[model samples]
Target: MEAGKHDRGRSGASIPGRFVAEAGLTVPRTVLIVSPYFPPSNLACVHRARHLANHLPAAGWTPIILCVDDRFYEQDPDPLLGSLVSPELEIVRVPALHARMTRRFGIGDLSLRAWSALSSRAADLLSARRIDAVLITGSPFYPMLMSRWIEPKFGVPVVLDFQDPWVSAWGADQKPLSKAGLSHQLALRLEGPALRKARFVTSVSTRQNEELAARHSWLDASRMAALPIGGDPGDLDLLRAMPDIRRSRLDPAMINLSYVGTALPRSHGLFRVLFKGLAEMRARQPGLAARLRLHFIGTSNQANDSETFSILPLAEAEGVADLVAEIPRRLAYAEALGLMARSHGLLLVGSDEAHYTASKIYPALLTKRPYLSLFHRLSSAHALLAAAGGGIHFSFTDANGLAGLPQDIAAGLERLALDPASLGQPRQDHLEPFSARAIAGSYAAIFDGLR
Candidate 1:
């Protein structure tokens, strides 16, 4: 149970030793990873690259990260995140056009602003080194375009990793001339060219891979990898070691349940369902509900936008406003974990999209506290949480399966408020499959096949 040792004998543990070439020379293959939002910038997408780079060496790939300098990020940087990065990794930071300079023009994506500098720097490294592959992870989907550009000139295979679906059906209901509609159209125009020369495409779930395959007839199952960004035990270990970081937000004396991360647009229905359950709990078990406090932290997508709150309004609508507390502004990476660690339990609400995967579940599982997870029945997250055991999981379909959702949520909240110990800990054997090291091994397999 050492810090950073989540996979001592678990499945998908890294293979020990260096890779050998046909000439019997022992050396790890090099991969240049294009990650525009890297550490110190506490955006969730950074963990995908951070964890991959931290563990890829054991899987026989040396990663050189190409990222935007932290100075350009509009969000306040987290120094703690910088400490979590592997000291051995090589990180190259290039200049990007600051948001201040581009906000007037309505161009805010860091990848778009950093495109020229990143591409030029990448070309220099490719020409100078023996790089075996290029992996561009996105949400700043614009950088994936480098795949189409890089492979042709450098003769290196490229992998485009998506933290989310590039072209989504989420905004289909918006007006044609609206911002969401315009963005969707632009994604439709760009995705094809970005993927035009990629040797392989990767996403967080199999459902997402299927979406990609369906969108592009040329993309087959064999050309894709579904790799979830599972939790890093090292994060918990680091949180435990940092004495300065404290859970000042919640009271230990009160029965508190925390929900962290941004609440998506499609998750509003789920929130209403959860709030209704709270209202039901208040009616049926007022005394128990009085002791329970439901917290929603970082519910807004914009980190510093305290004015934009998503969960509280719904809680007010359900008449459970007294029971619910929301902090729309984002917390630093470690501080968020500290709040979770001190809480009596965790709460996870899923999107209506079945393909949506909640990456936060991995870390919550590591916390060993009781969690109430409400997800679409077909979501990859629901399946993962159910298989691991311990948590209270309620799955619903978009249509008829939701009739009983409020009662289920009410019952789950009662157990969490009264007899939390009955929920037990997630089985270690079951949890190992979603560990960060295991995820890195999966990525290594896909990289090996491409080369």
Candidate 2:
């Protein structure tokens, strides 16, 4: 809700809603952040809300996080992540249909389970508080429909933040009656109306914004912004303080290179190229290959499912299984960061989609260790690495572009195995623009303009 000239606190004295450091403008506004997956749930998408809530206060906005209660979450809760949320932040958790009940009906998406609950709570908050804006983020893309629903009743503007594409041809090959295809069809029907009424839109990459614009011709270029979910240096600090958390998965005796995150189904081709390169390295430089160990941790997005392995099968097919270890179960957020922190080097593989930007690059950059990224030439991650002077990036255009990948991967592996320091550290100056604080300022700027 938009604040008046000032707002009254619990003591009933007037408090400035917003304080501009330079212009001395005191226009405090309240923004409700509707994110289904939040802290303790430990899904990576939660950080977008977590970091924003912590820093938005400085930008003259008081953020209220509206999330589903962690108890109803399908993923295992990580207590360490809960500790990282700011004490000052206002978080309201709402109940959702329990996953067990929903799972029986083949309806496990959090957005579907919690949409009515979120809608009810959001209406209550808007009615009670002086809310100026509503920012709805999605993985549970259904909540974004509230953008159209809330504004009409509450008289507040809404912004839709896309962490991933709501509508895409990603699973087009699936039978139309299948769950994935049905969801895609539903998205096709729903996304346009949900977006049409939004005050503005924002995404993590320029390509996503561009795609949204192309799909909905009415969306103007100025109505959208592309900003990465930058890393929080405080996360590293908190990670260091938690000694008992499983920190490093890399072997100290080996030349450890780690890739920590879910290996998407679309990323199979990228892995094929990478493993083929490793196979070549093993054949050409047996001694160095023996010493090098590549760790693909948390390759499965599903929690507590160790039986299914994404990278292991690929590695075996490429005949480099000995050099690669695939841990399919998801890891705690801090543990993932710790693995990157302790690694001799990091491995970043991008998706087949040119528009896909790996937001994990921000945290990887914060680790200060060299990262060798295999991405499309147009991927924002490639540009980010270049701008930050972080590490080596191998960009491919098409099937033909990947023809040299095996050789490139072989060379990169050899270099990291022998003279890792030659890659040099990422420049901190260039990285400053991508801090969590700066990202909040950018979000605030968009919020400030909508009013």
Candidate 3:
């Protein structure tokens, strides 16, 4: 078969004219997407890969996903996510090294364990087919390292997608540990070669792109693109089908504000600042304070291991423990959206790190519920929320900004509680660039250029 043209099977159905036009030819270019987390894993990492795989077909590219087998995941699987995978798309699953073995050896993660298998499968696929390019998304940054192995063997261009920084500097909230610093140095040393070999790189924020470029002088600035994470339209449809669960859980008499998703280690300081601001607001206006409740869903202070990190201690220190409610376990994507839909307002919390953009921002904006965000002045989310313009933005790092945060949050809550409709709808035009379809197109452009 010719490149970009796959066999249509026994029926031999003719290729659609629109697909040919969109592709700028009769055949669609093939790009392999390597992600350690995909459908049924219910991981935040899966959404971007899922969105890319779902929309790339229309953009004149065929996505063949290579993901970890389901048996490797520790989290409960969400079968509904599998529905998003199109029948035409091909998925290849690689067996993962047993979690027990990985834990016992203290060697990286499941991605590291399955590296050999992944490398072998990816090589075989490339050797047998016409793969235009390879795109690898990271968190299990291990899979990205495979580019060094695959690129040299198959001679296919490689693109590295940074969902989060592979090596993050320890923040103020994080205790300075010698071991942690050493690990960061080791990861950077290992990551340097593969990154240098990549033809293109993409990150969720411009700050991250800048940081990576600054860290690696060999990296060409022209080859990097900032591609933000976006909400899946199908997820929105699922939310519409579910009844508003927020109303049932929230007290009608109280003004409810909610923050969804897990709290990262660097976010502890910001949460402390927010809870302190809330306490100050409560002291001045006891009536409003009495009627206010802050709900945290799918959040925990201690995310991994036996380490206990509960935000309740901070809430108690801020004297708002009674007003706080915590749900420590993560909910399914659809369930989280239902919680957002019923709440009067949404809360976005970001770390002091400039490159740290909350992945939840896009979905929260899509809910059209009024939102209040606290982020570092330098954070990409600060700029994004300001431009989006439907919500309040507070800079947590500045003393002046910090002083007014409580009042800002209070005013936002009052507005949402009294008249949510007054906050109006999110500017869908501003939201267009962050839509999954648009982001997929951006990736397609990169793939096409590389091809």
Candidate 4:
């Protein structure tokens, strides 16, 4: 069988009968989307795959999602997110192996344990149905490695979607072979074969695609594509239906600034600088600082862990503990969006890594609430915010260098709080390309081209 060729079934066609006629439309192809995170599991990794699974049918392709059973995730499931899945979509939930003993060695996740089950299930699906393409998305990057196993045996073209860099250099500046660095090294060795075998590679940002391409000369530039994980309208719909939860929680007199999402190791430096700047601002103008409430919702050092990490201690050390509210627990996706919408302003903090693109940017913009974005000047987020306008950009380092970082962030915060109108309305044209529906169209085009 050819790499892109599909075997014809008894009907003398390459597509399965189930996908043939849906609502009077002929769905010509089926793409198996394999990911550990999907609806009910509200991990950030789930959104892109969920969006594609939800919207792909409109583009002449039916998405059959292969995801881990809900028991695999430690986080509370968001049943509301399940509404995003189309009734026509086929979701295969495979049970994962979870041994609590393996966690100390960093091998607890279902991605590692479910490989055997995943591979078996995938092979069965390919044999039973005329799956036109296989798309594996990641963070639990091992799923991408399945391409090496699937492509050769089934002769299906696999497309690897990278939501985050597989081999990250986020904290490699000082310690070249740090724990993360060593993990990245292992990933580099494992990813080589899968990347080479993949029909095409898609990343959330252009910089990530270029970086991956540069690292692998065997990968053609044309084979790499940038597909951002834009916001889903369904998320907004659910959020809009919920009561104004923020009204009861937040002080009406204060200027509320909310940051929703986890704080990874790469973002420690940015948070340090932010807290210090907030402290300095408080010292300079205590009255103004009293009016500001910085809320960190769904922000934690680790997922599903109850322990509070460095952020709270750092805030205390910087003397802004009184001004900061740290909600270490993760919120439901809709609740988080509603919180962002109700805030006086939104806060976006990117990692020091140059390729870091805050996936939250789209939803943040969609909130229509003014945002203050702080990121490394070299990061993709910097360019995105600059291009979109309506947001204040504070560089991690300035002309005066690190010494001026605190003042710069402080000034940006003041501007965001005092002159909210200056941020203006986000241009809808700039946001259209990042919509989940629009992104699915791009993926459909790639799948079509490969066929």
What candidate 1 gets wrong by more than 4 Å, as runs, is 1-17, 22-27, 241-245
Off by over 4 Å in 2: 1-27, 244-248
Candidate 4 positional error at 205, Å: 1.7
lDDT of 1 at 69: 84
Model 4 ranges off by over 4 Å: 1-27, 101-106, 171-182, 243-247, 301-303, 396-403
| Cα lDDT listed for each candidate | 0.85, 0.84, 0.77, 0.79
lDDT for 179 in candidate 4 is 67
Per-residue accuracy of model 3 over 258-362 as CA lDDT, tens digit each: 998888767787788788777767776788778888888778522232334377777988789998987777777767777887787888999868888888898
Tell me the TM-score of each prediction against the true structure.
Answer: 0.94, 0.94, 0.89, 0.88
Q: Mind giving the per-residue lDDT tens digits that candidate 2 earns over 1-451?
A: 1111111233543223484343564445888999999988888889899888888887778888888887789889988887888665677787788889989999999978887788888998899887888999987789998878788888899999988888865856568999999988888899899998899998888998888888889998998999888888888875675675465466678999999888987788999999999999889999989999999888887678887888988999999899998888888888888888889899999888878888788888888888788988888888878777657778898888876789988898888778878889888888777889999999989998986
Which candidate achieves the best lDDT against the true structure?
A: 1
Cα lDDT tens digits for candidate 1, 309-397 = 78888999999999999999988888888788888989988888989999888878878888999999989999988988788999998
Tens digits of per-residue lDDT, candidate 4, 1-451, equal 1111122223543323234555898655889999887878878888888888778877778787887777666667887776656655677778776646557677776678677767778888999887889999997888888888677788889999999988777523435467666776777788787797799999988888888887887889888898889877567787756666445657778899999988877777778788988987887878889999998876772446666755787788888889998887777777778888889999899887777888888788888898888877777678777787888877754434544688877888888888999889887777778888999999988998886
Query: Where's the lowest-lDDT run of ten residues in candidate 2?
Result: 1-10
What does candidate 4 score in Cα RMSD to the true structure?
5.5
Better model by TM-score, 1 or 4? 1
